[model samples]
Target: MVLKNILHHRFFENFLKYRYLLTELVKRDIKVRYRRSVLGIFWSFLEPLLFMIVLTIIFSTLFSRSIENYPVFLLSGRLVFMYFSQSTNGAMRSIKMNSPILKKLYVPKYIYTIALTLSALVTFLLSLIVLVMVMLATGAPFTPYIALFIVPTVLLTVFNIGVGLILATINVFFRDMEHLYGVFLTLLMYSSAIFFPPDVIPVDFQWILTWNPVYAMISLTRDLFLYGQMFDTFTLIFATISAIASLVIGLVLFYKYQDKFILHV
Candidate 1:
């Protein structure tokens, strides 16, 4: 009953009461991200476009014939992965970075992490336009299945928020976590099958991809956009469960540790 009440208070009541603060924080983060940059918001559209172009050139030369519609395949996965990477990295520093404001105010601590995640989500949605254009330009077939992209997208968002919360909480205690996570994200990016197809991976070692949540999301995105095929039911179920579990764990950790964050920060 204690745990249930805590969950309701932190996850439901606080969120509803502070919804405006969350929105303002999210807006502040978005503005801070593009502040003083001449390109400003256009960078959101450009980053993914440029990344797709560069990777398409490099990977296509190597695997072009092997992978049909390589641009669509790459962009679909890359865009989502970029959002996850950026959101988590930003959230990891959200608490420490905002320590001044946190020190002065009584705001709920999770606001910083959630705001950072939403800011990244906004950028991810903007870049998705480029992904759709790449699909159309590459002549990838789109079906009504495309409408269901929301399923994986929602799952991925929840996963990112959970991961962000945990990272934010940890980084408050461990200053070195930021540098360590940067290296980890680089390794995760390559291992996620963003630049390569899973078939090329050894059958014996395929479970690595099979168990990876990020890869599951990428595969689902590819199926929805490029292949116009139904997503694997098992993968979908596993990803949803994994996302929910992460969110619950993250919330508990953050709730437990939030009071101590100011001292560490």
Candidate 2:
């Protein structure tokens, strides 16, 4: 297949052209995130910790028995929320943020964004360590099923890569996309089941929550970490399809418009 050959060559070519740059970009991103800071990487844990504590107080004291193990409940949402939010935001800004290099050098447009995605992955790994610790400390049961989260985690990574590609490419032309993405991501965060349980939502709204692709990731996370069980077959199939669709659309957009990107910027 001619398409397959092009992809094969493209993959090998980009692998050679951008791999080292990606590595460096990831390192720089990590350093910049913690540069001149006392907490350094420890600060990665702070957001969820603070959020979990506040939510625990509100849910346990204020709501009074809305859910058991409120910290665990919040952690489920927080983990996936942090990953999706950071990856998408980072990716959306990737191309424009690397304008200097983009203009002077010949590199794949997707690399700039992948660099950001990889950077976020590094931080995600670091934060996941704290997540595991918090889970153990909170007396949540750990089992082999916990490994199941890795599937959706990988799916979410691919999903972000696709999202980043589309946004980064559009941002090169529209420019306002950067600001727009921030607002959209904020809406996405609240709509995601991060702070609220889906069951508490109205029956009419419950399907929306379950049907939301992001909610699947968050709910699967809760299932694995909070309940230590895999979701039913339908949910997994739907999530995989959604993730793949996003990837196909994103790559198509990136390839279609990438040639004009340099001129746009």
Candidate 3:
């Protein structure tokens, strides 16, 4: 009874009322992203492939022995990290970038950030085609476990939305957050073990990767896609908890500060 009531709540009703608007916003974001570019959407397929090729060329010899099918390993991790970086960055800037619309009309503010993340997700899904091509070219095994890749993808999306909300709210108040987040992302990319093998790090530092939610998602992808096995129990649990916590905190903060957004923007 309680669950049914919650499902029919006014908030959900409002969301449904604005569903069309959300769809349009997502389409606009994707279109804007590829506007004036020659290759356009194909870049989604090519960008990650090019990145994988360059990174593999440079690091293949270094970790080739330690990591089997180094290209597949590299590409899998890279895709996850790329999605995370792009989605969060887009979400962070969604508010200010659309300030004109926000000021002119009354719409759900969260819709802007959600639209950015969803647009990024669309590109990320399309990029997975490149990952498939690389896997086939490299002769990486295709296993049933690959179907479970959705688990981490969904979790990561939730986590992105949560973080996006927090960043969008803060970004409205502090324009400097955009610059600071760029530096933070650089540090995060290094710490994520994207280009390097985590095993190379000392045992003492293993905790760093273990505790990182983004690394957890990346490692989960590698496990399913490259290793042909189930993800670690701890990783799944940690990722779920981290994602939920982020969303809860983000909602709390976003709603609390959302009214003030009009003042700043």
- lDDT: the better of candidates 2 and 3: 3
Which scores greater on lDDT, model 1 or model 2?
Answer: 1
Q: In candidate 2, how many Å is residue 246 off?
A: 1.0
Per-residue lDDT value at 12 in model 3: 83
The order by descending lDDT is 3, 1, 2
lDDT of 1 by residue, 99-191 (tens): 999999998888889999988989988888998888878888879999998898899889999999999999999999999999999888877
| Predicted candidate 3 versus true structure: per-residue lDDT over 221-248, tens digit per residue | 9999889999899999999999999888
Candidate 2 structure, TM-score to reference: 0.92
lDDT of 2 by residue, 78-130 (tens): 87878777877888887777878889988777877887887887777777777
Residue 257 displacement (Å), model 2: 0.7
lDDT of 2 at 194: 75
| Overall lDDT per candidate, in order of appearance | 0.89, 0.79, 0.91
Q: Alpha carbon lDDT of residue 82, candidate 2?
A: 80
Q: At residue 180, give the lDDT of candidate 1.
A: 97
Clashing pairs in 2: none
Q: What is the TM-score of each candidate against the true structure?
A: 0.95, 0.92, 0.98
